[model samples]
Target: MRKVMFAMNISIDGCHEHTHFNPGEDLMDYFTGLMQDTGVIVYGRKTYELMVPFWPEVAKNRTGRPCDVAFADAMTRIEKIVLSRTLENADETTRIVRGDPEGLIRELKQQPGEKIAFSSTSLLPRLLEAGLIDELYLIVHPVLVGENKRLFDNFLVPEKLNYRLEYTRLFKSGAMALHYQKSE
Candidate 1:
């Protein structure tokens, strides 16, 4: 079974606005590795709209930094599954999925693949509550944005979610990549 990994770039205070945080080369490289390892990426409607146009442009023009370009290229190569009730169609590389999110995700996990990655935090709470996420890669940045969207905006877990810290990597920018697995 493929692991469901929830990966996100969040602030020290738990803010998760992509525009607010600037991913340095090393951070971008880390994301590139995740993209390369992931067979399919799951995105919510909002994130899909935000990334669909930008990453393809970066992939085509190679206009971004070396790390950005590499990340973009990797992103373009992977399969994308956007779960949205409003979105009807997407690019050839992506599939638009509607209906029960947890049930569909369970089916995806049973499939043979490298990994199924949850790239959108908006979709995390539901999957986390359903106990579908196997691991988490939280890239905690140094700065704190006082007011913004949080990583767990509407999270409501009945029981306390236990996690074991798999490892940690401190970046030069003072940001840290924290890896955790859901404790059984």
Candidate 2:
């Protein structure tokens, strides 16, 4: 069975907004590798809307930072599963799932693949609460936004979740990529 990984960019103070911090080359490369290995990328409606138009265009026109372009190209090629109640349609290559998002995700995890990469912070809490997340990969940025959405704001676990620290890499920009596997 494939593992479900929550790959998110978070601030020192736990903000999840991408606009809150800048990702350097190393960071982009790290994510690009992730996007390449991901068999299916899952997103919430808001995150889907935010990414749909931009990355695919970058894949076509090949504009922006080299790392960004590469990441975008990889993103364009990955399969996308969008969880939404109101979203009627999505990209031609993407699948729009209405109810039972968690069940659908479980089925995806059981399927033969590299891994299911979750790209939406909005759905993180729900997924984590369900004990569906196999790995938590957080690219912790250096900046601290005193006011903003909390990274684990939506997380509501019945009990404390324990994870084993797999590894950590410190980037030149002072950001660190922390990788952890959920404890059995």
Candidate 3:
């Protein structure tokens, strides 16, 4: 079985929404490189919709961020999976998985690959409850939300899960990427 991982960029207060990248930083390329090693990309319907268009177009707009364009090409090469309830047709190329998310992920674990990833905080706790995700790759932004979207937004009891810090890097904006694995 491959290492199932969850990669997400969130604000200090843990908001997974919004487009945030400081000047002189090519965040998309940074993330795309991560995807290059991934055989599959999975996301909540919202994240898929938000990224689908940009990923393709970023390739064409190699105006300044050359690496970003390369990243776009990398994104186009990978398989994309989306978890949605009401989506009828996700782009012709995207795989849409409806019904029980936990069951689907559990099934994915049985497949041949390094791992599967999910990019939704909304879905993270459920994955945790099911004990599916093996690790987490989180990009923690320094900006705080006095009141905004939360990362641990679910009814997850904090004490139930244990985290083993994997790595940390501080960016110029004070943002950082904190990787953690669930200690079983």
Q: Over 4 Å off in model 2, which ranges?
A: none
The alpha-carbon deviation from the true structure for residue 60 of candidate 2, after best TM-score superposition, in angstroms, is: 0.5
Per-residue lDDT of model 1, residues 119-153, tens digit only: 66777888898999999999999988989888887
Sort order, lDDT high to low: 1, 2, 3
Preferred candidate (TM-score higher): 2 or 3: 2
Clashing pairs in 1: none
lDDT of 1: 0.89
- Each model's lDDT comes to 0.89, 0.88, 0.74
Candidate 2, residue 42: the lDDT equals: 88
What does candidate 3 score on TM? 0.87
Can you tell me which runs of candidate 1 are displaced by over 4 Å? none
Off by over 4 Å in 3: 20-29, 60-64
Give the per-residue lDDT digits (tens) of candidate 3, residues 114-181: 55667766787888877778888788777776666667777466457778998886766676777888
